[model samples]
Target: MTNPDDPRSLELVETELPQLRDGEVLVKVQAAGVNRGDLLQARGYYPPPPGESEIIGLECAGVIEDPGTTGRRKGEAVGCLMAGGGYAEYVAVPEGQLMPIPEGYSPTETAAIVEVACTVWSNLGMLADVRPGQTVLIHGGAGGIGTFAIQLCRELGATVAVTAGSAEKLETCRELGADILINYREQDFSEELKGKCDVILDIMGAKYLQQNLRALNEDGQLIIIGLQGGVKAEINLGALLPRRLTVRGTTLRARSLEGKAEIVRSAVENVWPMLADGRISHHIHATFPLAEAAAAHELLDSGAVTGKIVLEV
Candidate 1:
């Protein structure tokens, strides 16, 4: 449970195992992925959806300990995309949110990839329908989501551009097939790529709103998945109408069970093959024991991490 007075206070305490509802299974978690959202929850900025666990984790890889009403056998390894409760040793997951572990990936690796795979695929594939020969820009390209998105856009035969705060981070993005790299600390990404981007996967919200609009080409799409900079930006309606641009903001955690299930299914059908065939890979920047989750969150919050962080249970 989060402390009202001290948002960053995290402690391990004994709690009863979650009771499973219909079509849900109990998972013995092996590892859980750490995301920016988890840090927000820790700081009391983000909270779990109504009727969901208040535990601070969004995704995990584990074995089914109790299959509940689902037909799956116990002890099957699976990766779960969750609304909450992944930090615990055991979590109740709707069967539809469970994904088969990709071939050749361990529980740790599976944990690293599940949320990112589902998130990127759902936005880039389902929402934008990014096509080949397009120019895609991804902000925060050194982070887990950006790195994964770089490879996916490349696999789709699009030119990839990315922005990071440091040269080293930009280099990492380049190695992952990024065609253009802009160091946001030193360069103006909007000025550098004006009217060139066909699709932009943005994490910075209000701070980059106008700049992102300036960077897009006609019929361009700007998909906002995070608000690290801020929220509540003023948009120019005139610019959007003349350019035929689209700005969409989405959060996966608040989606319904059926919605998340569809994303999981589509991610498995499309992105899973890329993982299996080695067209894309999971990058785990660091790992910590569940007891050191505070340290893990601190490291990720530092903005120096190049990829995903995992908390092993």
Candidate 2:
């Protein structure tokens, strides 16, 4: 892909594949996921970490060309959560990052699963330790992570509350089993949810910090994964102390290979079966061909997408 001065910098050009490194496998990409991070990278704001490919993609599902030492043979369909380089016709990924496509999913569906699944598993499941009967608040209810988080939290026995900018999006969240729907545009979420949130999955960083704190129940955990609002915020230790609240932040793109590998392992062992058995589902908003990546980015920027946008390779 081309890195240019414009937002529409994505270009399809012929490139040669490299020889596989240790624990890496060559995949013939079928479909890949488009994410907000990819858009930031397009605007020259987010670059790949050292040793990662400079291409702009985070997840993909494809057939294995060379499985390397992963114990799986060639030609098996697998999905991967990548550091970068899922926007191309092929990608070289660590074997541990690849999960066999869940039994009933298509390539496009499988492509959308890995990144969001691992993110929710790492933050909500592992870090926050969300429990049965807990009240969880998920911001951005219609987005890729929000939709999945709603379903996963519901399936795991948590009562879910979600915030979205529109009614249609909130309705989608309702289908995913979200119990409380707060239209952020029309409602003050902090007022609607005061003292009701046991766990809050937040993306609007500084903008919602105080409100999120106000909404949290005692011993609440707030995990901030995106900075859509602002980057800086003030934490009221006085309020946090009385509630015993915990606030944490994380990003998947910057994690070490070992950390990502462990997340992938846990998802494969735990979440993959849910997907295979129809307990979990992938939600796609739209798809564009590899050459139409610029248009995909345009749609993402419009902020109208209710779920993930995919690119067919």
Candidate 3:
């Protein structure tokens, strides 16, 4: 739990095991994934949904310790897409949010894959309906979501373009199948991709709004998943009208239980096969012991990490 006064002060302390509700199971967590949303929660900017756990983690891989009325066998290994509470030793997971671990993936790898896979698949595959021959632009291409999105887009037969902060990061994106790489620090991605992107996956929020609009082709869609940049921005309504452009913002954690369950099911059905066959690979930049979660948060916040971070229990 974050301290109200000093939000960055993370400490490991004993807490009661979460009680399982109907249709939920108790999972003994093996590893948990660290995400930018955790950082925001620690900073008091993001809060878990009502009636959810106060713990920071959003995804984990674990064994079912108590299969409370879910009919799942105890000791089953599962990857969990969570609303919250994944950072602890034990978490109560809704049965619908549980997924089988991909073949050839360990707990840490599974932890790294769950949240990003569901997010990317839900937005690109389900909502945007990304198709072959369409161009997709991803911001922060070297990060966890960006890297996963790049490979997934390639698998969907889309032309992938990415923007990263450095040439080294761009190279990483290239290796992951990004067709066009723009170093955002050196090049204006919007200018380079003007009216070329069929879909733009944006994390920068307001800072990139106008540029993202400029970069979109007619009838393009912009999916804003993160608000790393400021959230308030003025948009020209006329511009959107003439271009038939659409902008939608979404958050997985805030969705209804049924909504999350649908996403989890879709991700498992579609993305798990890719993971199992190595078409889309999970990337873990680093791992820290669960107790060193503060340090892990610092590392991710430093902007040096190229992929996901996992906290091992």
Tens-digit lDDT string for candidate 3 (127-172): 9999999999999999999999999999999999999999899999
Off by over 4 Å in 1: 1-8
Q: Model 3: C-alpha RMSD to truth?
A: 1.1
Q: What is the lDDT of residue 5 in candidate 3?
A: 46
Clashing pairs in 2: none
Q: Please list the C-alpha lDDT of all candidates, in the order they appear.
A: 0.94, 0.90, 0.94
- Tens digits of per-residue lDDT for model 2 on 16-87? 785688899999999999898888888888899998888889999999998777677889899998899899
Worst-scoring 10-residue span by lDDT in model 1:
1-10
Shift of residue 279 alpha carbon in model 3, Å: 0.5
lDDT of 2 at 300: 84
What's each prediction's TM-score? 0.98, 0.96, 0.98
lDDT of 1: 0.94
The most accurate candidate by lDDT is 3
